[model samples]
Target chain A: MSFPPLLEDLIRSLKVLPGVGAKSAQRMAFSLLEGDRLGGQKLAKTLAKAVDGIQHCTSCRNYTQSELCDICANPRRELNGEICVVATPSDVAAIEQTGHFQGRYFVLMGLLSPLDGIGPDELGLDRLANLMATTEVKELILATNPTVEGEATAHYIAEIAQQHNVRVSRIAQGVPVGGELEMVDGKTLGHAFSGRKTL
Target chain B: MSFPPLLEDLIRSLKVLPGVGAKSAQRMAFSLLEGDRLGGQKLAKTLAKAVDGIQHCTSCRNYTQSELCDICANPRRELNGEICVVATPSDVAAIEQTGHFQGRYFVLMGLLSPLDGIGPDELGLDRLANLMATTEVKELILATNPTVEGEATAHYIAEIAQQHNVRVSRIAQGVPVGGELEMVDGKTLGHAFSGRKTL
Candidate 1:
C-alpha cells in the first residue's frame, strides 16, 4: 500500500529479522511507532552493534568481537588434545549447555553436499585436517547433527581424522531423554534400533 | 555447567531477542557454531548494519535514516485535512496495506496505560495537538487497537482533539475478514456489539 514513505520503510526494515514474517514485521513496526521507540532504537542499535562487535574466532569459528571470540580466548577451555567438530556455532552452544564436554570446536561451515555444490572446501574439512596435523589433538569428537547431510559430513570428517592418526568418535543418536515411545517419530525409532547399545 | 568462559559469554549474548528463551538461544547459538564461521560473521555483520543504519522519521516516528521518513517526504499524503493517529508504526503499515485511507499519520509512539505507568506525555500527544493546530487537519482518525488501553487512549486523545475543534473517529472492530463468528473471542464480539451499525 502507498503510505507516507516513512511508514512503508519501517515494515520493510522489520522484515529483515530471521523468522519475522510480514505479520510479525507489522507488529514490530506498530510497537516501534506506538511507544516502544526506545525498544526499536535499542533493537536497531543492538543489531548494528552485534554485527560489528561479534565476529568468528579465527581458530574455532565461534562468534566473537575481538580477534578471538570469548570461547577461544578462555584459559579454562580444555584445549587438551580434544576438538569437537560441529556443523554450526549453535551446535557448540547446545553442547556447552549440557555442561559436559571439555574441549574446543571446529565449525564445519557446511556439509559435503556435492550435489548441492557444497564440497569439502566449503565445509572447511581441509582446515580441520590442517589443525589436527599442527596440534597435539588426541581426540576428535564428531558432533555433527543426525540429519543425512550431518551424518555424511561426520563420516567424512572421521575418515580424515583417522588418516591424521587422531582418535574419532560420534555423538550418540537414540531415543532422547523423556521421549515418548508412541510419539517418537519412526525415523528416530529406527535410528534408536540400529544404534542400540549394550549397557 | 563448566564451559569455556568465552563459550558461555557467546551463549549469553544471544538471549536479547524478543521471544528467545534460554533453550531457543541455546539452539541458535549451537546452530551458528555448527554452521560456517563465515556465515556467523555474515549474520553478525547484517545485525550491526541494520542497527546502525536505521533511525526514526522526525515527523511520523516511523523508522528512517534521515529526519523525515519516506511517507512524510511524499507530496500526496493526506492533503484533504485528515490525520490518522495510531499507536505504532505497524498500524500505519496495516492501514496502508489496505490502501483504504488517504491522509497523513501521527504515530502515538504507544498507548497510555495507567497500569504500565504510560501516559499522554510519553505518547507525544502534545506534539500531535501542535500538528493539528498548524496543519489543516479536520478529522483525527483514532486508529489505535481495540484493547482496553488502546480504547482508553483513543478516547483521551479524542477529548483533546475536541478542544482543538477537530473531529475524532475510531477504527471499527469486529470479526476480522477471515475470522469465523464462532471462533471470534468475547472481546471482539463485545466491541462489535457496542459499535454495531444500524442498517
Candidate 2:
C-alpha cells in the first residue's frame, strides 16, 4: 500500500527540510528514484560532506569550513574599518551582491528572541564586541531586518559599539525602490515619513 | 561576497530536487546548516542507502529492496486474475488507497514517447507481455492519465493484451465526481454522454 521501507524513510527524512511537506517529499523521492539516480547520489555525497565539514567562521559567525570567512580573512576589508552586522548569512550575501560596501561583516546567525531563548550570547554578541574592541573597526552598520526583534538586536549591538567608541548606524527604512507609495504598508510609510532626509 | 565553498556546494547540490530553485536551495542549505545538522546527516545517509538499495520488483517493476514487491508477492492479489497497468508507482499508491481493487499492478514507469525515444522496450512492455502471455491474468485495466501520450500508451498495451486473449478496459473518462456539468470540458462532456449507462 505504501512505498518500500527505504523509500519511505527517505521521504520522511526529506520532510526535515524547511517548507517541504508530505507531497513535496514524495515527488522529490520519485523524481530522483525514477529519472535522476546519478544526481541523487551526487546530492547525497555533497550533503554528507557539507554537513560533516562546514563550520562557523571564527570572526564573523558566518558559515565556513576554515577558521575565518573570506571577507574576514581579507586584509583590505580590515583596512576599511567598517563592519556591517546582519542577522543571517543570506543577509550578508544580499549586501555583498550590491557591490558597494567595502567593509567586513558580523553575522549574528539569529535575532534576539528571548521567548525562544535566543539572546546576546546566542547571537554571538560577545565575539562582535571582542572584534570591535580589538580591531580598528570605526563604523558598525546595522543591517538586520525591520522587525521588532531585529530592531531590538540592532539597539543592543549599538550599545556595545558605543562602549567601544565605534560609530553605529541603522540601514534606512522606506518605501522600496520601484514600489508604488500607495501599495506600501502603513508601518513602512510611517517609517518613511519619520526617517525623511534632505536632498 | 559569496557563501563558503562547502555551503555553496550544498546549495548547488540541493537544486537536483524537482521544483527547487536558487533561492529555495539556499534556504534549504541554510536551514539544515543552521538548525538541523543532525537531520541533514540523517537525510544524507538515508538518501545514499535508498539510491543504492532500492530496485525494481522482479514481478511488477515497482520499487522494492527485495525480489518481489509486497503486492505482487501476495497470493490473495493474484487470485483475482486482474492486472491494472499504470504509468507510475504513484498511481498504484493512489489505487491502493481506495481499497477497492484487489488485483496486481504493472508499472510502466513512463509513457510511450517516440520523440523522446521511449518505446515499448523502454517502458518494459516486453516483460508486461511475457506476464500476460504466461500468467492467468483475465483482464487488464489501463489506468494511465487522461493525456495524449497516456491514451496512446493505453491503446498500445490494449493491442498486446488482445494478442494474449486478455480482456482490456480503460478507466472511464467523464465529468469527475462532485464537479459541475457546466464547468466540465467539452471532450469530457462528450465522453460522459457516450459512456453513460443505466442507473
* Fraction of native A-B contacts kept, per candidate: 0.10, 0.85
What docking grade does candidate 1 earn?
Answer: incorrect
TM-score of chain A of each: 0.87, 0.95
Off by over 4 Å in 2: A174-199, B178-183
lDDT leader = 2
Q: How many clashes in each structure?
A: 41, 0
Score every model by TM-score.
0.67, 0.92
Task: List ranges where model 1 is wrong by over 4 Å.
Answer: A1-16, A23-80, A94-104, A131-137, A164-166, A175-199, B1-17, B21-79, B96-100, B127-137, B161-165, B172-199
lDDT of 1 by residue, A1-199 (tens): 5344444555665454446577765565544444344444444444444444655677876666677666666656645667898876667767889878777888876677889899998776777888888878889998887888998988888899889989999988878999799998898899899999889
- Model 1 C-alpha lDDT per residue in residues B29-145, reported as the tens digit of each score: 555444334445544443444444656566766666677776777767757678898887667767888888877888876789877878888888888888878878879999888
Residue B28, model 1: Cα distance from true site in angstroms: 6.7
